[model samples]
Target: MSDDDAERPLKRHKPQHEHQETNVTEIERSPDFWFDDGNIVLQAGPTQFRVAKSMLSRHSSVFRDMFSLPNPTSESTVEGCPVVVLAGDTNTDWKHLLAVMYPAICYDLTKPNIMTVISVLRLSKKYDLPAFRKESIRRLRGDLPSKLEDFRKLPVAGWLYLGEVSDVQLSRTIALAKELCLWSILPAAFYGLIESIFNHDGSYRPVGLSLADEISLLKGYARLTRLNTEAPNRAWLEAESPCVPCDDCLFRTLCRSRCASLRSTLQAQQAGPGAVFSGWDENWSDEFCGPCIKAAKEAYNDKQLEIWKQLPSFFGLPDWEELRKMDLDAGE
Candidate 1:
C-alpha cells in the first residue's frame, strides 16, 4: 500500500443510536510533579525532567493552579496527585505550555467546572491523549440531552468537527441532548433539532417534537388556569418561577419579551408624551419569542394540507392513504 493508504485507519462500523466510543481511564492514579514560581517541573526518564509555565497570569488557570504547588516529595505517591503525564510526546516545555494554556483558554474562573470542561473537550482531542479525550467526550455525551444546546455553541475544534459524522447520527445524538446545551449552538442546533424531529426509525419513522411543540406545551400550561375552576392557582410566572431563572434558561427571552404596554407604563413617568419604542428588538421575538409561534402557525395554515399531506407519508403518522382505503373498504 502507498504511504498515504497505509496511514489511513480502518473505519469502524457503528450501529444506529450507538453512542460514540471514547478512551478514558478512572483517575485512580496521579502524577508526581512540582510547581514553583509560575513553572511546572516533572521527572521524565532517568536523569531528566521537564518544566513550563504561563507567559502571563491571565493566560491560563491550569498553570496558576499547578504553579502554586511545590514539587512532589519522596514520600508522595501517585494517588491524589493532580498532574497527568501526556503519553508519547516527550517535550517537557511543550507539555508545560499546554498545562498553562489549555486551562486559560477553556475555563472562565467565574463559571462552574462543568462549563470549563465544555471548552477543554476539543483540546483533549487535539493532544490525542486517549484518556483525557475519552473522558471529555464521555462527559459531554453523558450529559447528553441536557448538554445538547451547549454542544451546539461549543467550538467545533476537534475530531468531532471532522465531516465523518452522518446526518442520521448527528440528529439522533442531538435529539437526545439537553435543550439548553443545544440552544447555545443556535443555527446548528436549530438545524439539528429540526432533523431530530423528522427522523426515520425503520418501519416507523417517528415524528419528534419541534420548537413549536415546546412553545405550545408552555402555552398549554399557561392556559390551564382558564380550563379548570378548582385547579390550584397554576400561574406560569411566580416568585418561585421568575421570568428568568438561570443564566442558561431556554425560555428566558420568550417569558420576558418586551411589552408595549409596559413601555407605555414606564413612559407615563417621563416628561414628554412622546413614546420610546419598547426598545425590544423585533428579531428577538421572531427568533425566540411567542411571535415566532404565531408566525409559524400562520404560515402552516397558508400551506394548507399540502405541507402536512406528506407528514403521514414521511412518518407513517395515521397514514392518510391507508385510512382512506380503510374507509372505502368499510363503505363496500
Candidate 2:
C-alpha cells in the first residue's frame, strides 16, 4: 500500500495504527487467538486477534492471496503487524476456527460443538479453507443425513445427534442452512422441527425464526399431518382395509386405543411417520399377530421412506439430490 494509506488513522471499530498502538484500549484482544509473536492482526469488529500469517495462509487460499498483497485495508496495526479488517466474520467464529488451527497439533473434529462447527463452516466457506469446510459439513450431516437409513439410526425422537437438539437449536441450524445454502440438512431438520411445533402449546414460533421459515414450518406441519392421516403412513391406524386382529394381538388393541389418545400418550407416534416407522418400538410390534406385524413393518419401511422423501417438499424444498446440487458442499 502507499505510505500515505499506511499512515492512515484507525477508524471506528478498528485496531490502532502502529505509531499510536497504545491507543488500542478500545480494541479487545481475542483471548483465544492472540499470540505474543504473531505477525498479523485480524480485526473482527472491535476485537483483534494476533496470529501468524504463514499458518493462516496454509489452511486458507483466501489468506494466501490476501497476505501475498502488500496490505489490505484496516490501514491499522497492532505492534508491527498489519491489521486486516474482517467485515462480515465474527470474532467468535474466527477464534473458534483459529483455536482449532493453532497451539494444538490435533483436535477431534467429530462430535464437534454445534456452534463451533457452524462457525468453522461459515469462516471456512468464506476463507476457502476446504478441509475445515468439508469436515464441518461431515459433522453436520452425520446427525442430519440426506439418506433415510442414516437418519433412522438416531433415536426415535432424536432426529439430530447434536446435544439436546432443542427447538432453539433446530431453528438455529435452519437459519444457518438458509444463510449458507446448506440444503442437504434441511429435510431432517424440518422433520425434527415439526415435532417441536406440534408439541408447542399454541406458540410455535421461536425467537429469530424468520417469517418465511415460520410459514414453511406451519405449512410443512399441515402437510405432514395430512400425510399421516392418509393411507400407507397411517396404515397402522387401519382406516382403510381395516385389520381384524388375531385373538392374541395385544398391540392391535393398544394401537387402536392409542390412536384415540392424545399425542402425549405415544411420544414417538406424536412425531408420526418419521419416528414411528423407524422401527422405534420393535418390541411393541412383537405383540401383534404374524401377518399384522409383517404388514406394519412394510408400512414402516415404505411409509417412513416416503415420509423422508417428501419432507423436503413439505417445507417447499427440492428433492434431496436437487437440494444437494444447491449446496456449496455439493459435487465434492
Cα lDDT listed for each candidate? 0.32, 0.69
In angstroms, give how far residue 278 of model 2 lies from its true place. Answer: 5.1
lDDT of 1 by residue, 170-262 (tens): 433333323212222222322333333322221213334455544532333223212222111111222344222234445654435533333
Q: In angstroms, how far off is 224's CA in candidate 1? A: 24
Per-candidate alpha-carbon RMSD to the true structure: 21.5, 6.1
lDDT of 2 at 199: 50
* Model 2 regions more than 4 Å off: 1-19, 22-25, 71-75, 103-110, 156-161, 200-205, 230-233, 236-239, 242-278, 289-292
Clashing pairs in 2: none
- Candidate 1 residue spans exceeding 4 A from truth: 1-51, 55-58, 75-332
